[model samples]
Target: MYERTARESMCKFCKYVIKIYGNQYLRKPNLNDIQQLYEVHESKHGFPEMLGSLYCMHWEWFNCPTAWRGQYLRGDHRHPTVALEVVASQDLWIWHVYFGVACSNNNLNVLEQSPLFNDIESGVAPDYSFEIDGVKYKYGYYLVDGIYH
Candidate 1:
């Protein structure tokens, strides 16, 4: 009974937080935001039009339901988990976030499901052009590790 009550309280708190700060905290960066991010990242990382660093994190679900354990299990971990892919700048401002993916999936799989490139696909992305070593390049890019292709 205590566990049930705690779970309900947690759910209510989560919903309230989302309702109050969801738009500001949990949204993709717009054109102006992207431009600013590119400038900051480029000045610091020596990469023109660079947005931010991309990474994925796995969070263990200690209270995972028994029926869904197999689907969320990653391998040999003996626990169910969920993944969160994020693109965050040096200042810790999150530009992109994709969560709730099963741990069994890899970064590429999660990326495929993410809306990271949705603006590009919809032709609403801002124009990003910069000169590097006398070579003019267009389009901003994120600094992802070898895991992402």
Candidate 2:
């Protein structure tokens, strides 16, 4: 009952947020927005055509069901957990987020299962123009650790 109530409240809150700020803050960035982001990112971080930084965080799932306990456990974390992956700009605006992956899955698994990454990889990615070391490229960069394969 508590879980159901909490889930309903959270859904309502999310709907409220989307209704109030979705157009300007929650929606996907357009090509012009991406260009502006790249400019700001470059001037601050010195990385050309950078869209954002990617990171994954794990949240302990104290009430995880018994059947899924093993699926959510990793060797490093004694308890079950859920993983959340996010890409955020320097200003802390979250450009993308994928949540609810079992902690047993690493960043690579999370990314591979992410619909956003699939969409981006399917050619909807922005054509960010930049040159590095005298070589030109058309892809925007998202800074991530070597955890991804």
Clashes of each: 0, 0
Residue range 20-101, candidate 2, lDDT tens digits = 9989987778888788888998899888778888888898888989999999998888789898888898889988887857
Q: What is the TM-score of each candidate against the true structure?
A: 0.70, 0.77
**Model 2 / residue 68 / CA error / Å:** 1.4
| Tens-digit lDDT track of model 1 for 1-149 | 69999999999999999999988986768878887887887788877677788898887898999998889998857678888888888899877777857788887787767777566556676665555665555544432342211
- Which 10-residue window in model 1 sums to the lowest lDDT? 140-149
* Top lDDT prediction, candidate number: 2
After TM-score superposition, the amount by which residue 109's alpha carbon in candidate 1 deviates from its true location, in angstroms, is 1.1
> Which stretches of candidate 1 lie above 4 Å from their native place?
1-12, 19-23, 127-149
Clashes of 2: 0
C-alpha displacement of 70 in model 2, angstroms?
A: 1.2
lDDT value, candidate 1, whole model: 0.76
Candidate topping TM-score: 2
